[model samples]
Structures are given as C-alpha cells and as structure tokens.
Target chain A: MQLTGGQILCESLIREGVDVVFGLPGGAILPLYGTLPQYKDRIRHILVRHEQGAAMAADGYARATGKVGVCWATSGPGATNLVTGLACSSMDSVPIVAITGQVARPTIGKDAFQEIDVTGVTLPITKHNYLVMHASEIARTIREAFYIASSGRPGVVLVDIPRDVFQEKAEFGEYPTTVDLPGYKPVLDGNISQILRAARLIKEAQRPVVLAGHGVLLSRAMDELREFAEKTQTPVITTLLGLSGFPQTHYLSLGMPGMHGVAWASLALDEADLIIGLGARFDDRVTGDLKRFAPNAKIIHVDVDPSEIGKSVATAVPIVGDLKRVLKQLIANVEPAIHVEWMAHLDQLRREHPSLYIRPTEKLLPQYVIREISEVTDGRAVIVTGVGQHQMWTALHYTFKEPYTMITSGGLGAMGFEVPAAMGAQVGVPDRVVWSIAGDGGFQMTMSELATIAENNIPVKFAIINNNFLGMVRQWQEFFYNREYSASGYTKNPDFVKLAEAFGILGLRVTERSQVRDAIIKAMEWAGPVVVDFVVEEEENVYPMIPAGTSVDQLIEEPQMVEERR
Target chain B: MPKGPASHTIVALVQDRPGVLNRVASMFRRRGYNIVSLSVGHSEQPGFSRMTFVVNGDDHTIEQVRNQLDRLIDVVKVSDLSDENVVARELALIKVQATPYNRSEIIQLVDIFRANIVDVSPDSLIIEVTGDEDKVDSLLQLLKSFGVRELMRTGRVAMLRGANAYPGTPSANGNQ
Candidate 1:
C-alpha cells in the first residue's frame, strides 16, 4: 500500500511490536509528528522534556525489557542531544534505536537551518547507521536499525530520515526487510577444547571459585550458573554488575567482589586456586592490581565477546561463547566434587566478617534504609540505583534474586540514572514494584523525570538517601585528600519531599532512624509514584575500599580519620 | 630496512561518502603504511566505493598493513592484491621538458610504452600512460633522463584474473 515515509515508519514499528516511542517534535520532524496521529492506537508516543532524557528513557526501557527501545529526535541540536545517552547505551550494551529527522535532501550540504550530520556524529557510538533519502527505504532502514540494535552484543543504532523523504509517498512494507549480515556472526557454542581444559582445571583445583558478571545476567544464564556452582561446590564471587546473578542469600554466593566489594568475597577471590570467570570483565575496580588479583588462580574465562576474554587478565583457558551455553556444558561434563575444607574456610571467613550494617538507634544509616526497603518490597521489586555511596549500600544490603531486577548503569556508572531508569522499568513491567534509590546529588540531576512518573501514574517508589552532599566524592575527599572539603558539602538544597509534592506525587520524609521502616512502608502504600527522603549521615563512607594499586588483602577495614582536617 | 626495494598492494571497499577517502589515507599515514600510489572510485554498487593502495613493504610489512586496515571502521573489506590478483594498473601523467633535440626521442619512448601525448606546450609535453604498476614506474624512470617537469600518478587498481577469488566475492563463499 502507498504511504508516506513517516507513515511507513510508524506502521513498521507497529509490525515490529513496538508499543511506545519517546520523542519531542521539531521543525525537521514535523512530517513524522504529523503522521504519528494515524498510528496513535498501536503506538504510544511519550513527549520527554529533553532529547537526552528521551534517549536515556529508551535505554532504561531496553535494559528492563530486553527489547530494542526506540527514541526519536529532530535535526541539529536535538540529534546532537542524544549523543550522551547513545554513548551510555553503547558502553553498557543496551539495545536502543534512535531515529532523527534531517533537513531535506536538497539542503543537506548547504548548511540548511537546523541541519547537522547526525549520521556522521553518531557513527562511532552506534552499531550501524543509515541516512534514508528515499521514501521507500524508510521501513527497511528502521527495520535494519532495530535488528542491528537488538542483535549480538547489543548497542544503539541510528536511522536519519530527511524531512522531504518523510513527506514523500512510497509503497510501504513490513519491517525487517531481510536478515542477511554475512560479517556479523555471533559465536554461541562454546569451544569444546577450552571447555574441556576448564573442566580439567576445575577437577584439579583444591579451592576454586566462580566469578560471575553482568554477562551472565545478559545471557539469562542464572540457572546454569547456579547448577554449575552447586555441581562443583564452588563459591561464587560476583562483581557489582553481577550482583543479581546468584541469590544473595545463597550459602555459596560470596557477594560483590571489587574495590568496594565485600571483604570476604575479595579475600576469597585472592586465595582461590582456580578462578572460573563467567561474563564479567575484570575492571580495575575488581582487580585493584592486575598482578595481585587472583595471583595464584588458574583462570578460566568465558564471555560472549571474544575481545574481553584476555583483554584485562590472562586466562589459562579462554572460552568465547554465550556464558549460559558454556556454563551448561561445564556442568554436564564435569563430575560433582565437594570442597569440604574450602567451604569450611569460607564459612569461617563469613562468620568472622559478615556484611555488617550498624542500625543506630538515633541516626539513620543508608544501609538500614535499604534493608528496610528491601524487606518492605518483599524482594520482588526492581531496584535501580544512582552511583556512589548509596549505590554501594544497595548493592550490599539488598538481595536481588532475579536478573534484570537490579537495572542500574553499571558499566557507565552514570549518576542520575536511577529515577528515569526506574520510570522506564515501571513502564515496561507495570505490575512489578519499581524503586529508584538515589543519593542526594544524583536525585537532583534528573529529578525532572519525576514528572514522568506523575504523568504516567507509574507506581515507582523513589528513595533518596539525602546526605546533604555529594556523598561519594565527599567520601573520597575525606579519605584520600585529607578532608580538604573542596565543594563536597551541600549546605543549601531544596526539600525533596516538597519537590516530589510539587510534581503531583506523594511525598514522605524520615529523619529519625526509627521512622525509616514506617516511612518506606507508607511510600510503597501510595497508589501512584511516591518519594521518600531519608536524611542519612553526611560523612558515612563505603568501607572495604581496596586503595589504588593495592591487593584485595590490603583493603582498609574501616574508614580512616582524616590525618589533617582542613 | 632492506635497502633494496619492497612493495605491496592492498584493495579496500568503503562507504561512498565525502571525507572517507581522506580518513582512509590519513589512517594509513598515521599507522605508518607507506603509500606508493592510491586510487579511489565508485564501486559495483551505487552507495559503495573502492580504493586500491600500493605500499613499499615486505611480507611482514604487508601483514601489518592488512591488520591496520582491518581495524579501521570505514574499511569494509581489505585484500592484498600483490599475492591474489593479476590485473594491476596505474595511470600516470608526466610532463617532460621537450627541447627540439629530445622531442622526437621522447615521442619514440612514449610510443614504445604505448603512451599518448595528451598535451604539448612549446617547452614541455605531457604524456599519459596507463599500465601495470611496474610498467608505469619503468616509464617514469625512463622519462626522468629528459628532465621531467611535472608528474601525477594514480595508485594501482587491481582485479583478479579468471576469478580465482576475492575475499568478499559471492563465489568465495559459494553461497550465491
């Protein structure tokens, strides 16, 4: 049937099962906005305040639903505004498709008003990009963009349509024109030789530990990981990104292992004889000193991305394939073994220094607040967190049993990611409880998304650990920079409760430590979105920090007093 | 440094867009691939272009060239033409100072090389020649004695003889 490029785009999106699109109208995109009304029943268009927020919302949607999130923007500045969100998605491997309208084809190189080379600008950050000057190519290009975005090691894809092309009439076709990419084959089967070698190492090792990462969650291999761990009786230490892979309450689960990871987990990683890595790249935070990280372990690295296998740490056996497939093979091939002595040692360490949270009777701690919230939500809620002390606290205190339930910007560590991400998560999974746990500083950055919650009536709960400062930066300055207190204190800030109420959402504030539980319960009880601001201690720092260039054994057990206070 | 002579040929496909050629050449320069000659033009498809680059290198150096070119995002496919293809040609335009004493001699050499005199001024004659890269180099070397005034050369462009194979060719995969 004959249709305009813009109409074809909307129709193709519907065919691809797209339910929503986040965007704003502009001069170059008028044709698309004009055609959007016809497909209004099939596609829900959300108008975001800014293009950056739109892109991030798409990212959040993709992360939560495992689908390619779609966002649209106009020409020039609007297209450029999606750059940060695109980069964030690219870094974190979130599947997103960003469509932008361009100036007419005739005016492309003449520097027409509101015209920028968006395809060129986004080239480096996208999986692939296309500039469709022909109306007939619109459906196909959008299809290709979605395919590229959602396939393999997923990332953002872009399609630029000229304004004139969007207005031109053409024969429309269903999306996914064709699936032919000769050069883009993703390896799914594990290399048998490497798997056998890994099994041999596992069989020989006296004390072995499994290190799971975000790849496991991305591959949805939680069941295989659990079976593999149980079969081998291997203790599993997860990176911050791998927090939700194994149930936090599991006896074999040695929680987050990194610079701010649990003391026992890091120590166990350091002492293991065999280290089987699943889906986790050894970031600097995880491997404080590469030379000292798992110094004595024979490493078996399994990851979907081949480049990640030996990029950071040397692997004795490198299995490049989907983690889920590889883990299942390992579980099937290897005989079950019991490391009674190793488990005893780990149990002793766990007993000695557990993940401790001091529940002060007078002042509220963020850890206590997180634990109470987790209990109140019944561990079924999806928790999104902003970066810093509160992020670490949530990682430590909350027990995430399901994959995609803890959706935060782990790779990017992007501040202000939680609120918008939580909103997107709530939209994706309407029935599930969603929580945005943020520090004071992160909450203020994208607090505008609070309006999104109110407008959509998404029942996402916001918990702001209001320490009245940029807590993470302040902690670093306090510990590493001799407490110079350079721009770390937030002496003047708005009342978040009032800010929430202004956005037409329920608001609550908790000052006394005793009010934390009741306040969280009340926030969750509100029908729509609600915000609870907890005034946490200003100087509380994340403990068990493995100082730069130091081994896990050299971690600071407790916060050190500033040698010279400024 | 062999100190004698070494050369290599590479063919690459890139998206048909402005600044793409410059990006490819600049990448070669940045990565230390010595280009002896380079050619670029539209390919079999409308929105795709092909580039052929000849560099002075030995086996090891040629391997490095292939590896470096593979890393460039704009370079869709890279093939070493030296080992795989036959039909290699470079176009050269040479302007020689043609005094009365040497004009006929230069013309005779041009005819022997099957080169055409495209332009002639009172003082200089411009000869255009298209042949295998070696033939073009030979002609240039012979013309140098007559006091060559100006020279412009296109990089070697090559195609395989009788379709033994090209990397991205449909026949190479036997899928078509």
Candidate 2:
C-alpha cells in the first residue's frame, strides 16, 4: 500500500498490536498526529499534558500489561523531556517505545528551530535508539523497536523520525514476522549442567533464601517461582521492583529485603548458607555495603543479562538465562527439600523484631493512610507511588497478591512518577481501580497532569500524602546533618484540594485521624479523577534505615534526636 | 575502583549502521570511560564494523564500561585483550624539533628504534614509529628530552597470536 511516513507509523503501530499511545503532540510530530484520525478505531491516543508524563504513562502501561508501551513527542525539548522516563524504564527494565519527531533531514545538525541530537543525547539511557532518515525505514524500525523493547530484559527503545521524512511517500509492506537482530540474541534457557547444579545447591542449602526480582515478573514466571519456592520450602525475599512478584501474604514470603527492607529479610540474607538470586541485580539499595551483604551465602545468580551475573558479587553458580526457563528446568530436575531450622529462625526473628505501627495518635499518620487504602482496595487497585516517605510506606504496608500490581520507580526512584503511571495503569486495565499515591513534594512535581486526568476523564484516584516537607530528605538531614533543615521544608504550598478542584476534578481533604477512611471512600466512590489531601503528621520518619555506605546490619531503628525530643 | 588508572584494550564487533560509531563513542563519554585512544574500520563481514579502544579506568569502572558496551544491541561481541598473548601495534608520526646541530643525534635515535623519518623539513623531522604501547611510550619519552614538535598515534589494533578464540571468529584478521 502507498503511504506517507505518518500513515506508515500509525499503521505499523496498529499492525504491531498497539492499542493505546500516551503523548502530547508538537510541531514536528504533527504529521503523525494528523494521521491519527485514520486509525482512531484501532488505536487510542491519550493526550498527556507533558511529554514526561506521556513517557511515564507508557512505562506504567507496559508494567501493567507486559507490552511495549508507546509514547510520542516532537523534537528537542519534547524529546529531551522523555529522557527521565526512558532512564527510569531502562533502570527498572520496563519495555517502552518513545517516538520523537526530528527536524527535516537537512536541518538536523544546523540547530534548526526545534532540532537536537536526541538520539545522541539518549544513547546511554536507552536500550537502543534509531534516527530514521528515510520513510522506508519507518515500518521496519517500528517493528524492530517493539521487538527490542519487549524482548528479554526489556527496556526503552527510542526512534527519532524527521519531519520531512514523515511527509515523504513510501510503500507500506507486511510487518516482519520475526526480528532480524543477530546481535541481540539473549540466552533463553540454562544449560542442563548449570540447572542441575542449582538444584543440588537448593537441596543441600541449610539456610537458603530466594532473592526474587523484577525479572520474574518480566518473564511472567510467578507461578514457577511460587512452585519452586513451595517445592523447596524456601523463604522468598523481594527486591523493591520485585514487590508483587510473589504473593506477599504467603507463608514463605518475607516482604521487602534491602536498605529499608523488613528486618527479618535482611537478617536472613546476612545469615543464609545459600542465596538464590532470581533475576535480581545486587543493586546498591538492595545491598547496603557489598562487602557485608550475604556474607555467609554461597550465591547462585540467574539472569538473562550476562553482564549482571557476576558484576557485583562472586558467585558459586552463574546461570545466564531467562528466569522463567531456568526456574522451570530446575523444577523438573530438583528434589524438594525442607530446611525446618532455617524457617524457624526467620519466623522467630520476624516475631521478635516485628514491624511497628504508630501508637494511637490523634494526628492522621501516613502509614495509617496507606494501610487504609490497602484495606479498601484489597488487591483490586493497581497501586502506583511516587518516591519518598509515601513510597516506602506503600511498599511496607500494601499486600499485593498478583505480580506487577505495584509499579514504582524502583531503580531510578524518580519523583512525580505516580500520577502519569497510574493514568497508564488505569488506561491499560480499565476494569481495575488505579490509585496514585504521591508525597507532597513529589505530587507537585508532575501534578500538571491533573488537567490531563480531567481532560481524559481517566477516573484515577489520587492520594496526596501532604506533610508540607520533603519528608525523606528531611529525615536524612535530621539523622545525619545535625538537623539544619536546609531547603527541606516548604516555605509555601498550594492547597491540594483547591488545586484538584481547579483542574475540574473531585477534591477532598482529611486533616484529622477520624476523617481518613471517609475521605478515601469519598474519592474512591466519586471517581472521575478525585484527589484526596491526606494531611499527615508533619514530623514522621521511615525507620530501620541502613545509613548510606554502611552494612545492612547497622540499621538505625528510630530517629535519635527526634525520639529524644518526643 | 583500584588505586591507579588501569589501561585496557577492548576489541568489539558492531553492526555497521548510521550513528553506531557515535552511539559507541557517546556511551563511553557519557559513562565517564576515558578512552586513551580508539580506532575503527570495516570488518570482514559486510555489515559489521570492528572497533579497538584503549580505555583508562580502575578495575570496577572498566568492567562496568565493558558491560555497558556489550549491552548495546549494535555490539556483536566485546573482548578485553589485556591478559591475552596477542600481537599489538600502534603507528605514530612524531615531528621532532630537529636542527642542523642535532639532526644526526635525532637520526641515530630514530634508527635505533627502527623508525622511519617520513618527512624532513627545514626545522623538523617527522618520524613514523610503530610498536606496542610501552615501546611507543618509551620512544615518546626519549623524544621528550629533545625538542619534540608534535605527535599523533593511530592507537592500537590487536589479534591473538596463534589462533582465534573460535572457528570463523569475527576477531579474525581478514579485515586488517
């Protein structure tokens, strides 16, 4: 069929089975947007207020559906704005394809009106990128982009299309049935010997713990992981991105294990005879000090990315393959072993150093707010959180039964990720409820999306945990910097209720402890994008923090000076 | 990270495509991998480019740099040649500040190293030298005592001496 670059891009996206696109149109990207009407029946384009939100929305959608989420932006600033979202996705291995418009070929490097070397700028951050100089390359590039974005260890792929190229005529051909990337062949299955070795290690391990990660969800191997854990009777410790990868309420599930992880999980990691790391990188956040992390463990690391196999720690067994396939192979070859002593020790520790909640207080606390939301949603709502105290509160409190239900910026820890991601989640899973939990500082970072929510009528419920301070950073300052409080507290702030109201969305505020549930209930019920102002305690801290550069064992249970003052 | 900057020669085969070289170079620059020197050319394969780079970094940084390099889809394979017994050479054109008074001494020095004087001007002699990095560094160090005008090195290209890493290896020397 005869088609221009614009038509070809739209048709190619539809051919690739893309149902939704999140983006804001600009001058260079107008041609593609012009062709949107022709394919509107097959594709839905959500107009985000900012390109960053669009990119993040795509990321959210990808996280929820395991598809390559697509976003569009124009040249220069629009392209650069997607950098954060691209980097965030790359860090966390979420597959997203961000299409940006470029200046006409002739003026690309001449610093024309809206031209920047976006492909060059995004080189390090993206999984891969291409700048389309010809219209003929559009279809193949889109196919390749989606293929690259969704394959093993998925990541963001960007394609920059020139404006003139978008207007050029080309022949639209059939979509390639398979990717022709010879250089990108990821190992899909572990060697039999390695799988057998892993099984032997599991059977012999007296104090074994399975360190699960995002790869398990990425591979859709939750069942395999659960069965493997069940067959072996091993306690599972989840990384930040690995949350919801396992049923957190299961008997062997030891919530999150890292810097701010559950005390028992970290302790298990410290004392384990064998650490079976499944698709989890030994990220700095997960291992506070590398030298002291899992000192007693004979490590077995399995991941599709060969680079991550022995990058951080020396391992006894390194199996570089897809987590799903490796776990499946091991399940067939392995014998189930129960380490009663290990489970008992972990249970005893968990009971001894139980997670504490705020004592009965008149002031509405942040933890209570998150707990109440978890209680109401009950694994039905897809929870997205922005980075800060609220994010930790959500991770520690929420019990997500299914995989990929909790989407936060685990690797990059980017602020302002919640609203747009929640929008994408809601759009992807319209039948399910979507909640965006943001800190006061982070909520304002991308709150411009409130207009997007109102414009799209996205029906996303937002909970702004308003503490009037950058709570996390302030907590750090209070503990380490002698409480000088440099630029941590807000000198002035917008009233969130009024702000949401201004965007033409339902707005409510809960100032006292008694109003928490009712306010959340009101927002959940009145949902055409409702924002709840949760005015939480001004001075709250996420406790059991492993101070930076220290071992996991040396955690500060409570803020010293603050507790003394109290 | 180690105590001092460690130099490593990394050879990589990459898909020959538009902006691929820029992609590889930009990755190094962005990730703070200091490229001491680099050279690239078409390989034996029609659609592949072979790149050899001399990077200076600590142990940890270099490992990460190599990992990041290999992660790019264009990169077919990355091999670090630091510990391998290999044939390595670098070409350098050093124009030395030689005069009538010291021309003979410079000629002797060049002759001792078996370097060729490619061009001789009124006040300077351009000497072309090829050898390993240590020998190249020694000649340059020797020239430093004299008035060395300018120098340029084509960086280093290397191959395993006896046999390739595997059959029909992309690391073969047919492209050279």
Candidate 3:
C-alpha cells in the first residue's frame, strides 16, 4: 500500500498488536497526529499533560503488562524530557519504545528551531536506535524498534522520524517485521552437567539458601523456585529488586536481604553454606562489605545474562540460562533433601530478630497507612510507589500475593515515578484498582500528572505520605551527617487536597491517624482520580541500615540510638 | 603458570582506509602479539575490511588480549581461529637474494605449496600463498631459509561456517 510515513507507522504499530499509546502531540509530530484520528478505534491514545508523564506512563504500562510500551514526542525539549523516564526504564530493564518527531530533513544539522540530536543523546541509554530520513523506512524502523525493545535483556529503543518524512508519500510494503540478531541469542537451556553439579551442591550442603531476584519474576518461574525451596526445605532470601519473587507470608520466605533489609535475613545470608543466586545481581548495596558477604557460602549463580554470572561474586556453579527453564530442569533432575535442622535454625533467628512494625498512634504512621490501604483494597489492586521512605514502607508493609502487582522504580529509584506509572497501570488494566503510594517530596515532582488523570478520567487512587521533608535523605543526614538538616525539610508546601481539587479531581486530607482509613475510602470512592494526603510523623527512618563499607552484620537497628545515644 | 609457545589467531574487522593495516601492525608491535602469519582482505560488504593474524602465546592469554582488542569498538568481532571454523590465507612478497643454484629450489618449493609468483623482478619473487595458518607458517619458514629481504603478508579474514548471519539483523526478532 502506498501511504504517508505517518500512516505507515500507525499501520505497523497496529500489526505489532499495540492497543494503547501514551503521548502528547506537538508541531513536529503534527503529521503523525493527523493520521491518528483514522486509527483512533484501534489505538487508544492517552494524552498526558507533559512529555515526561507520557514516557513514565509508557514505563508503567510496560512494567505491568510485560509488553513494549510505546510513547511519542516531538523534537528538542520534547525528546529531551523523555530522557529521565527512558533512563529509568533502561536501568529497570523495562521494554519501552520511544518515537520522537524531528524537524524537516532540510532543516536538520542547520541548528533548526526546536531541533536536538536526540539519537546521539539516547545512544548510551537505548538498546538500539534509528533515524528515518526516508519515508519508506518508517514501517521497517518501527517494527525493528519494537523488536529490539522487547528482546534479550530488554531496554528502550528509539526511532527519530523527521517531519518532512512524515509528510512525504512513499511505497510502503509490509516488510518482514522481525529482528534477526545473530550475536544476541539469550541462552534458555542450561548445561545438564552444570545443573547436576549445582543440585549436588544443594543436596550436600548443611545450610543452603536460595537467593532469588527479579529474574525469577521476569522468567515467570516463581512456581518452580517455590517448589525447589519447599522440596529441599531451604530458606529463601530476596534482594530488593526480588521482593515479589516469593510471598512474604511463606514459611521459608526471608524478605529483602540487604541494607534496610531485616537483620535476620541478612544474617541468614551470612550463615548459609551454599548460596543459590537466581537472576539477581550482587549490587554493592545488597553485598555490604563484599569481602564478608556470604563468606561461608559456595555461590551458584544462574542468570540469563552471562555477563552478570561472575561479574561481582565468583560462582562455583555458573548456569547461564533462563531462570525459569533452569529451575524447572533442576527440579526434575535433583531429589529433594530434608534440611530440618537448617529450618529450625532460621526459625529461631526469625523469632529473635523479627520485622518489627510500630502501630499507628494519634499521628498517622506511613506503614499503617500502606497496610490499611492494602487491606481495604483486598490485596488485589496494582500498587505503584515512588522512591524513599514511602517506597520502603510499601515494600516492607504491603503484601503483594501476585507477581507484577507491585510496580516501583526499583533499579533507578527515580522520584515522581509512582503517580504517572499508576496512571499508566490504570490505563493498562482499567477495571482493576490502581494505587500510587508516594512521598510528599517525590509526589510534588510530577504531581502535574494529576491533570493527566483528571483529563483522562483515570480512576487511580493516590496515597501521599506527607511528611514535610525528603525523608530518605533526611534519614541519611540525621544518622551520617551529624543531624545537620540542610534543605531536606520542606517547611512550606502547597496543600495537596487543594491542589487536587484545583485539578478538578476529588481530594481528601487526613491529619490524624484515626482518619486514615476513612480518607482512603472516600478517595477510592471518587468517580475519577483522587489524591489522599496523610500527614505522617516527621524524621521517621527506615531501619536495619548497613552503614557504608560495613558488613551486613554491622547494621544500625535503631537510627536514633546510633545517631544520638551511641 | 608457565607460558608455552601456542599458536594464536587474531581476526579483526576494520574500517577500510589507507594505512589501517600499518596502524594495526604497529599496535601489535607495541602490545607484543608475536605475529607468525597475517592476512587481510575486503569483506563481502563494501568499504569494510577484515584482517586475521596468527600469533604464538597461551590460548587463554591470547583470548584475553583479543577481548581487550574487541573493546576498541572499531574492531567489530574477534574470534580465536584455533577453536573456530575458519579459512586463513596470506600474501608474502619475499625479495630473497636468489642465485642460480637457489632459484630452482625456491621455485620448486613455491610450486609445491601452490604459491604464485605475482611479480618476478629478476632479483626477487613476490609469492602469494593462500591456505590455513600452518601452511602459511610453513611457507614463511621455508622462505626464511632463502635469506629473504622484504616480506609483506596479508592478515586472515574469516566468516563462520554454514551461514552468513550478521548480529542485530532485522530478522533477529524471533524471541520477541
């Protein structure tokens, strides 16, 4: 079919099974917008107030649906604005395709108005990129972009299309829409010998532990991981990124093991005889004082990316394959071994150093707010969170029973992610409840997305933990920087309830702890999006922090004691 | 570990340009990969060059050096030819001081190895030998006995067996 570049792009996206697009239109993308009306029924276009929100929305959609989320933007600032969100996606291994409109071909390289070298800027961040100078290449480039975005070690892919190309007519043929990367094969089947050796190690070890990471969720191998753990009676320790790999309520499940992780979980890692790492990178945060991390364990690392296997901690048995496939193979080959003594030891430690949560008093506690919200929603709603105190509280308190039910910026720790991401998640699963748990500081960063929520009528509930400070940074300053509070505290701030009301959305403010549940219920009952600002106690810190360069055993249990009393 | 004189195969895909071969050889000279034999040629794709080299070192150590070379970003892909399926050939211009007695011996040796005398200037013979790395090394050893004056050998160029599949091809979207 002979069609314009814009029409070709739309057709190719349709063929790729793209049902939704999150973006804002500009002059450079006017041609593409011109063709959007015809395909409105096939593609639901969610117009965001800012380009940043659009990119983050796409990120949220990708994280939730495991599909290559697509977003479009115009030239210059429009393309540059998507950089933060794209970097966030790249860091988190989210598959996103960002399409940006460029100035006319003739005006390129001449310092044309509203023009920027987006491809050059995004090279380091994206998996691959293309600049479509010719209109004929539009369909092929879009197809390739989606393919690249969703492939091995998935990341963002960008396609910069000039405005002139979009306006031009071209012979658009349905080219084979598949990528053939010879050097990009992700090994899914592990070597049988290696698996047997690892299984033998597991069986012979006195105290073995399974340290599962995000890879288990990515491979959808939670069932296999659970079976292996239960059959062998080995306790499971998860990294921060691997939080949802196992249910926190499970008998063998030791929650997140690292800085800010429970003391018992970190100690269990130190005491294990054999450490089985699945799809988890040994980040410095996770392996505090690397020299002492899991010193007694013979590490067995299984990951899809070969580079990650022996990059940080050396592995005794390195299985380079998909975690899901490899776990299934191990379960089939290895006989279950009883570790009754080990289970008893872990249980004793759990009882000794339990995960302690203080009940809410007259002033609202963030942990109580998250727990109440989780209970009220029946643990079925998709919860998104921004980084800092609220994010940690959500991870530590909220119990997510299903995979992908909780989406947060785990790798990048980008502020202002939750609200826009929740908006995107709501778009992806409209009937399901979606909540954005955010800190006051992080919430205000991209709170403009409230307009996006109101405009689109997205029924997203926002729970703002309003402690008038950058809680995480302030915690660090309080403990590590002699309690010298710089610009961390926000003495003056806009009333979130008024702000939400001004955006034509429902709003609720809960100052006292007793009002939390009622406020949340009222906000959730709103026809459109609603924001609930819960006034939390200031100077609250996430405990069990392993100070820098210290071993996991040397954790600061109570920050106040470490800072002042000690 | 004690190092052994093991053979090393260095394959490089370079941008086709003037003096690129000289620049690469100088790099080898500075870094110390004992080049036993070398070959170079234009690839199937235009304006791109492929070069191969045979060096003497431990296989693992040589692979580590090749990994460093591969990190150069300009050098597309590097493979140890010792373990890979490859075709290696070299062209050496040997300006040996040939006399009447030694002339027949050199000619006979060239004929045995299927090497062609592309240029015979009465005083010297430019022999082009196309074969595996061992064959090239043998020819070079035999030519050295003739008191060679000047030698120019093209490095190796190789493609994997069975198919010509490039990385990041459009059809590589099967997993997705």
What TM-score does each model's chain B reach against the true chain B? Answer: 0.79, 0.83, 0.59
lDDT of 2 by residue, A1-566 (tens): 88999999988898889999998888898888888899889999888889999999999999988888999899999999998988999999999999999998888789999889998888888889999999998999999998888887899899999998999999987867787886787778887777878888888899999999999999999999999999999999998889899998899999887767778888889999999999999898888889888888999999888778667887788887889998999899888888888899999998887454455777788989988998888865789999988998888888888787899998899999998898898888887788898889988889988888899898999999999999999888887788878999997989888889899998888898888888878888885889998888987888667777777658656556345533
Report the backbone clash tally of model 2.
0
The DockQ-derived docking category for candidate 3 is: incorrect
Fnat per model, in the order given? 0.00, 0.41, 0.00
In TM-score terms, which candidate is top? 2
Choose 1 or 2, whichever is better by DockQ. Answer: 2
Which regions in candidate 3 have their CA more than 4 angstroms from the true location?
A175-177, A359-361, A564-566, B1-176
- lDDT per residue (tens digit) for residues B124-168 in model 3: 777777876578779889889888788765655555665644332
Between prediction 1 and prediction 3, which has the larger TM-score? 1
What are the per-residue Cα lDDT tens digits for candidate 3 across A453-522?
A: 8988999999999899999999888877888888999989899989999999888888887888888787
Q: After superposition, how far is residue B172 of candidate 2 from its true place, in Å?
A: 20
Tell me how far the alpha carbon of residue A245 in candidate 3 is from the true structure, in angstroms, after superposition. Answer: 2.8
Model 2 local distance difference test score: 0.86
